[model samples]
Target: MQEKAVVYINSDDSGRGFLGAGGSQALETFVDEIAQNVIDPQANVSVFDRAKAHELVDASSAKAKKEILERKGSRLEALGSGSDFSSFLQHLGIPTLNVGYGGEDGGGEYHSIYDSYDDYVRFKDPGFKYGVTLAQTTGHAVLRMADADLLPFDFRSLYKTLDKYAKEVSELAEKMRENTEMDNQLIKSNDYAIAADPTKHEQLPVAKAEVPKLDFSALKTALDSLKKSADKLALSWTAASATDADKDKLNKLLFHAEQQLLSAEGLPRRPWYRHTIYAPGFYTGYGVKTLPGIREAIEQRNFTEAQQQIGVVAGSIMQLATYLAKPL
Candidate 1:
């Protein structure tokens, strides 16, 4: 049997901008390095980051999102337990990335009667260039992970990414509040006359209760601590040198850092899954929920549960921050 390299990341477009692709910013860069080495600089590429990374969600600003895509890449999409990497990532809390390459191919050729190696070789990726690109990208990542003394798990990148989630959820709550108020105004003014269908008799929609003012102070505090610790570690990362033991210790710590994110009582009812930061949505199956506890609760309009989940997420973040603050 021919030896093959383990490909952890898939580098492709989902492709309007980078919507379906999922991975870390660091790993994205790692994969991009491989692609840059092989693929032409001028090669036509498509990306997807336009979507809010959800099924019910749509891109907020196409022009602004595309600007981000043109500059660096997509907003690092979260991992869903839909792939082979789920166990290593969502369950065990290991770092993961998804990368793939494609953009030349257009619509019509999907998973149907026409998806074959012959057609792929002739039409999609002529000369199997993408196949080479994929090989190089995955091989290099594996090689680096295997050979490096210090593991490439950058917690600062993690902090920044997570901070965005914190901000996003806060904003989501506020947005929901505003929407609810507007709808309730319409409901009150029209006496709940709005029905699904104007012609047939349909149940009238009720005025939604206001999205309560959620106290995210605990979460905010935890994130503040996490940022400081992450910043400190990043500085250590840049220091002149360190003993092999220290580097090894730091690597081990980084490796196990994900464990700190596991809520002892995982995700409301699904105790099997841990790792609080990322999880598949209760409703959106394969679509991931960042800050799942808080995000899902708010989405479901369970203000009480949302408040409790906020505490859970805060505790998890504090656990991670405390772990990161450890001496090298």
Candidate 2:
């Protein structure tokens, strides 16, 4: 058995994880940082961020274009299963990333007759330039990670990502509360008139139960602790000057830091996925659900479960923070 895992990176020319790549914000930052050094004239790569709307980051060779990549959006989408990175990140809590170029091709090729040489030249990659650039870009990522003195990881970025997810879940609960109240008010006012046939009287739908306010204090407190711990780790690592053997030992600890996020019980009903941070949508087969326990509960209108999941996710985050706080 291996003592520790360094990192996991999955790159596919055709198939990739659903929605976007699965990783901490640091992973996206690391990839973008290295990609800037790649001088590719043909394949002007643009990065899509964590947001569903996809604020683009142009990681091209040009100076103006490359600078814009960081300013706009600089994070990766939460990864879901259906690609190679799933098992590593979800099950084992390995620090994972999926790197590839996509979202540009307009769906037509299926590796079938439509994907003929003529169509490929016109629609897909024009001159196989993207392929060359892909090799160069991915190559640099691999080499840098393999050669870095101290496992090129930054926990501070991860703490910020967790903070963002916590806020998003709180907002999700709030929005649900607002919508539920409005719908219930409409029900009381008897506003279920059929649009197609106003004359055809229909039974009014039963009023939904009012969404109660969820307590997010636990989550907020946990995130605050995480921020402090992450900052401490970052500051110490920057100043440390250790022997090669000591550095290797520290790298091993960093390698397994993500494993601290896993819960023994796992998500609501899925025990196989232990990580609290990223998981496949139980219903949206090909899509991702970040902070799955909390997000999915809110989405399914299970406020009770949502309340409980907030604690679960908070505990997990706190555990990760505590793990990171250990002397480096």
Candidate 3:
């Protein structure tokens, strides 16, 4: 967390990258390597590793350079940033760039009891330059997203993310089924009289009753159908440019269409959040539980519940695409 630490290269912040051994060291190495090799090399020697506050702040260049720096840090944090933005950037195919400023927030009540007007003025962002950096960084992101025609959504990234999650859920269900069989065996081996308890049952907590084999056929069908629907809508939007009125209406409608994917009810229990695309775990506050309905079902050992949620989510996806398919 260097003062005025700037990144040298453009990065895609996945937010789950720091999950293994040596993650912090790796982040330091990544930033140090990129700064030394890329950014510092390109800039005037005076700006090369100044190790102090930037005396003259250039908002425009800082904005561009900040993106590069944010990307690099994002790359390292992707190993594990431990925030709500993780799944959207890492798993949901969003080309996310985190750009908040001030290293002081990294420690000492910055995010806890210590972070206050007094502490901020006394220790962190004393000059308010970092706050300026934050403003510039946010403006840059907003401008980029607003001006871009493609909405910055990359379905390929989302597809891969979903595939991995699906595999994890499938494996968990299998493990539960395997454990159930093991329990049945241990029970049969017990001596007949003592094994059957009358008042105080000593029977092993039954492994979640064998989970039935799920037919992912329905899910695959739904995904394929949605893809076709999305493709059609994309084509329509592109063709609508011929009519100014239609184009304007299409743009506005398409812009808000994604918002429809969310459910105000949120997950089964947690209600504070509303986005259907992502959510925090009910138990793991800051941690994301992607496809919470299915993931939690498996984690809770509720196989039938998991299957039901799968259908629910699959339906949601298709419905979103169908909504997108409408002509403005």
Per-candidate TM-scores read 0.79, 0.84, 0.55
Error of model 1, residue 183, in angstroms: 2.0
| Model 2 agreement with the true structure over 1-328: per-residue lDDT tens digits | 1244567877767321112344756576676666556544333333222222233343335675555554643556678888877778888888887766556645766767786777766666677765665676678778988888877777778877888888898898898889889988877776754333556665657788888899999999888988998788777667654544457656776788888888899898999998899999999996888899999998888989999989988898888778888875
Q: Which whole-number lDDT from 0 to 100 does residue 68 have in model 1?
A: 50
Please provide, for model 1 over 177-280, each residue's C-alpha lDDT reduced to its tens digit, 9 standing for 90 to 100. 99999888978887557445677777776887888899999999998998898888877766613544457667667667777888778888777677788888
Q: Could you tell which candidate, 2 or 3, scores higher by lDDT?
A: 2
Best by TM-score: 2
Model 3 accuracy (lDDT, Cα) = 0.47
Please write out the lDDT profile of model 3 over residues 118-177, one tens digit for every residue: 766656555654454344334444554456453333232333344455667677778877
TM-score of 2: 0.84
The window of 10 residues in a row where model 3 has the poorest summed lDDT is 14-23
Q: lDDT of each prediction vs. the true structure? A: 0.68, 0.73, 0.47
- Say which candidate scores most in lDDT: 2
In candidate 1, which residue ranges exceed 4 Å CA deviation? Answer: 1-21, 24-38, 41-75, 103-111, 191-202, 240-246
